[model samples]
Target: MLSDTDLQAIGLTLRLATTTTLILFVVGTPIAWWLARTRSRWKGPIGAVVALPLVLPPTVLGFYLLVAMGPNGPVGQLTQSLGIGLLPFTFWGLVVASVFYSFPFMVQPVQNAFEAMGERPLEAAATLRASPLDRFFTVAVPLSLPGFATAGILTFAHTVGEFGVVLMIGGNIPGVTRVASVQIYDYVEALEYGNAHRLAAVLLVFSFLVLLALYSWRPDLRKT
Candidate 1:
């Protein structure tokens, strides 16, 4: 029988990953759209910053986030003044950490898909009386579906596996911040290798299935 604590950790992980992916979709799409189409001088710097999490150590990111979300920090003080506590050590904090850590996963694929599309489809759409918004919704977004799927899956999976950042920001409060990755860490620390293996295998299988779907269906989804 699965312990209640384990079940709670799994549920929280899924919730955190789902919320993080949703936020990434909302936030990353516009940035990716701009990056793909814009010729601005700042594009390189902006892209690099977006991809920072991919290259930077997770502990470094977590350290920065910890400071930023601490009581006296900008984010913390600002939110506290508004009658809302800083979200650190809570579910929302986990979401924020996941989004920040998984940002490149969300952005790069969408950008690639958009770049792959080039300008022809939107140009043709404009010729057919489609407005900018219309062109994006009708033409650009459809062409970018595969990328979005890939990005969403990657972001969710990455978020699920996050450990250092969640530990820094969320502090392992069971049923609140005790996500599966952290739970696995606890099991390993307690020398329960069997439990850790079980959890890790589950995550591995789930990620493999998601990537398989993405890679297999991607070719079929290409624009004609």
Candidate 2:
């Protein structure tokens, strides 16, 4: 049976995933919009950078982040000067890592959605005297709801499963950085197979159910 700590880990994982998803939505939406609309040659390089984490080893990414967020690192120094101190091995650090790790997941979907939309709708809106921001909120965003939903689900699920990056940067600080994935690792390391199994099963079922809802709910709207 899963213990109270195990349950807390599950709750923390969900909270972390939720926070990451929300931040990605706010941060990624504009980037994706620009990527879709921009025609500059530099956009390709920028897009590649945004997508690099998808292919890079988690440890490599985590290692770099660990250095960057360490006490003597740039982020740490800036935070320390401001009295915030190094964020590493803290909840905020976990949030930052999860944001970077999950960014591409959120961006790519919204970008694809915008690209598929093309300029037709925007042009049509312009004829109706709509401003760019107005058209985006009134036309583009509503049209991209499905894509956003898919992206949010995938990003949250991916964040929930993160281990290497979180473990390396978060240091398994209980109730702060000890997310479900790290807790599962702790269980396995102590040969607590039953606890690990339960946690793994819970995550599996939860992810599957969310994905099943996203994929199976709309055969008609999918054409968009």
Alpha-carbon RMSD to native, per candidate: 1.3, 1.3
Kindly list the per-residue Cα lDDT of model 1 for residues 1-224, writing each as its tens digit. 45688788889989989999999999999999999999999999999999999998988899898899889889889878987788788888778888899999999999999999899999999999999999999999998898888899888888888888988888889989999889989999999998888887877888788779877877787744
Candidate 2 collision pairs: none
Candidate 2 residue lDDT tens string, 158-209? 9998988998898887899999999989889999888889988988898889
Q: lDDT (0-100) at residue 6 of candidate 2?
A: 86
TM-score versus the correct structure, for each prediction: 0.95, 0.96
Residue 123, candidate 1: Cα error in Å is 0.9
Segments in model 2 whose C-alpha atoms lie over 4 Å from true places: 218-220
Each candidate's lDDT (Cα)? 0.89, 0.90
- Residue-pair clashes per candidate: 0, 0
